[model samples]
Target: MITDTNHLTSLREQFAALRAQGLRARDAARKLALSEGDVMAAHAANQMHPDVAEHSLYTTMPLDSDWVNLLQGLENCGPVMALTRNDSVVHEKIGVYRNVSATGLMGLALGPEIDLRLFLSKWHAGFHVVEHTPKGEQHSLQFFDAHGRAVHKVHARPQTDLNALEALVQRHARPEARPVFMPGSPLRPPILADDRIDAPGLREAWSAMNDTHQFFTLLRKFEVDRAQSFRLMEGVHTRRTPLVSVQWLLEAAAGTGLPIMVFAGNEGCLQIHTGAVHRIEVMGPWLNVLDEGFNLHLRHDHVAESWLVTKPTVDGPVTSIELFDEQGQVIAMFFGERKPGKPELPAWRALAHQLAQGPVTVAQTEAA
Candidate 1:
């Protein structure tokens, strides 16, 4: 927060030193106790190093203006990787930006290869970033919310239409200048109550739910956070499951070849994987699903709550394992792949049952 112009030169030098030491902008910021964007802007302001002659890791091209327009321009950039992630998950899909359109702060990209739910209201800042690597130059467009957390990112594949991408960036690039960004406000999550919840009422509402979308309204009506509501309605609508249940869920889906919906989202976007999982890989605490057009990375240890939720639907009982973080934000959700006229797959339900704490009571068995 050295806001003075005189300190800018010194800031860039320090950032450059860190980059020389091989620290990524994000991890460097974590060590320096600053936002990632702040660290990037500092070095980006520096003149191109005379030693390097041109492109360097210090280079960052700030892309400003109508973010939607920037996205639409990408429609011509063929075969790119679209990425959206939050704290616990990283979702990447490879596809062209096709059939893009927007109205107000909402957007849609119902391309056959790529599906996205865009909430443009949170798209406050963006940049076309370049990092020099041994293999060659890596290019990416990264967007951030008001709080400086990454919202969505796009990266070019080896066979992508680079000419089109370059043209788009050139058209929308902010004038030659130093890029600066405000850190904005930190997240202030509410301190919701643990008591006074209408547990029975919530269970009753859960039983009456005919659509999954109604769950949000149900939480609002009960004035409870998702994780808190799970605790309050424990014996009824939700059951506390083993922490290992997540691994079990993925393994079950892979073992049985069940098509399930894997949902990971932040405030701005929700990325989904709606098919059978063929590959499951674990690296340390992170669990990953590596498929052809999809990748899901989840840190199993960050799961503060994992609840097997049963809500009645016209098609029958819909069961989901909803994972939450410490702030009560949903890190991810898993549901059996199903259509309007279909009940949840029997295998999926049975897998969820294996994670349950105790024997299923007669009433619970009758829920579907």
Candidate 2:
């Protein structure tokens, strides 16, 4: 928590100036050499000063720490936008918050429209933010990790129930509370050499998988990094693909009207998009999917590696296109849409094979 009045005032001035220059909060905070949470916390503290309050562009109210209950309360807010992102991707889905439940620190939102895997343990601070925009006031619930990185955000839509939202806010608002943030921890080093891992045992375990979910257990059982596991089982179940694989995959899916699943998340929240994508566009380094109720922005330049992975499941072989960054962290994953009792879509499998073969000339790149 930043308690120095002068420092908070300076941050507000600089933040406001940057906002005026048309920089989003995340970029603006990065430009100011601070975490987005720190900047917001400063503004939250500034609200107490009448002089500062009058000139601020946004106001934040710290919320109570009952993350699960607060999320459950959001069900009253009809259609809302759920956003989750990492350094390389931004995933936005619009739907109601339903089937929201949690056990301990793990949670899930399994609504058909809004699906999420929540790790509440990393959820540290939350705020109800109201920003004054030219169009009107924009309201959102934003949550962050202990390191101040954003985990998830829920934005109100035009169809949202304003009264219920307001009531929920009033019920959970902790106006007098202070939110503190710590600096981010250092990044983990690269994975160990393949020679040091149990190659035969890892391959045997990979071959015996009965469900896609078991992959995580395999990684833990072998104490191997995800990418390293792929490297160890490259020939048997994993195959490296070109960096253009993602671009080709999205374009192909859009062209064939294929319904696919896209997964992207940070440490605190995993957001999934399921359905066909129609419009695909590229601007500079970003490859985007702009569709009704869903929007994906991916940094094509950050794709340090791509792979085609197949996991044996009771239903059949489940295939996915996995992307990773230079630091070996997963950027995003792509798969053919299918239910638990169903086999992988043959057409989707063919497309994955094409991606594995090599990159193709992108059919279109112009923004729609």
Candidate 1 per-residue lDDT, tens place, 92-195, comes to: 88887777778887787767567777888887667777767777877888887766677888999997888898899888777454445566556656746676
| Alpha-carbon deviation at 152 in model 2, angstroms | 0.2
Q: Give the TM-score of candidate 2.
A: 0.95
RMSD of each: 4.5, 3.1
For candidate 2, which ten residues in a row score worst on lDDT? 359-368
Q: Over the stretch 304-359, how does candidate 2's per-residue lDDT look in tens digits? A: 98999999999999999999999889999999999999999987887887788885
TM-score of each: 0.84, 0.95
On a 0 to 100 scale, what is the lDDT of residue 80 in model 2?
A: 98
Model 1 misplacement above 4 A: 1-24, 43-55, 99-103, 176-185, 357-368
Candidate 2, backbone clash total: 0
On TM-score, the leading prediction is: 2
lDDT of each: 0.76, 0.89
Pick out the ten consecutive residues of candidate 1 with the lowest summed lDDT: 359-368
